[model samples]
Target: TEADPLADAVAAAVAEANEPQPSAPTGPPLPGGEKDAFRVAVGQCWNVGSLSTDALGTTVVVAVAMQETGVPDGGSIRMLSFSGGSEAAALQAFEAARRAIIRCGARGFPLPVEKFSQWRDIEMTFNPEGMQFR
Candidate 1:
């Protein structure tokens, strides 16, 4: 049986074309000033003074939707996931994280406007470990 070179080339071309194209360029996973700074800002407001022992032991990921003015949409704040503790503990931790954002968010974050899309939908992690409890 003779190999069909044309058929193979056509298949390869179709496969390449079907592959998804890369989206716009974005920042690296870490060390990028914008994202790092954003996290730091949120962390600065992460108050853990009244958190319970179990809550303090848990870690959670908070999902927040942001407005164009750098303010978070109150209704859109939710806990996406958690670890290191029970569901009850996670809820407690999640509340702490939510309050943090709300507290410091009164005046809105100072993120750049042009990069709205990047910070528009944020999923931030809250780890109570290693944090100073007052």
Candidate 2:
């Protein structure tokens, strides 16, 4: 089966956000430090039907949460929260939760990549099942 474009985009975005930084010098570790906190929780379940129309919606929700909480990197948050930590880990938890929800939604009902071009044309509905002329 072909990869879902929306899911691929979201995964790429999250991966980019979580990429390791090379410049931070080793020093006295930050107080209350922990291991990789960024991750998607598996046991927690969600109804994909409740998520927005596409992965973009999910990405937006995650980005907003990250902006609000100030942790753009997902791994740190995943490790701290799911691994057992504080409520301070809630925002990260939300991000992971939203992403998972969207991912599940995408898996259950994928959007077609061909629909992307429709955004440029008002007449285009981006409906894959719609009629095509010869």
User: Which candidate has the highest lDDT of all?
Assistant: 1
Local accuracy of candidate 1 as per-residue lDDT tens digits, 1-134: 89899999999999999876543324433238877777777788888878888888899999998887989898899999999899999999999899889887878888887776567788888998754444
lDDT score, candidate 2:
0.32
Model 2 pairs in collision: 37-75, 37-76, 37-78, 37-79, 38-74, 38-75, 38-76
Q: Looking at model 2, report the run of 10 residues with the lowest lDDT sum.
A: 120-129
Mind giving the per-residue lDDT tens digits that candidate 2 earns over 1-134? 99999999999999988986544323344222111112212112332333333321321112211222222223322322222323434343455454653443333322223332211111101111121122
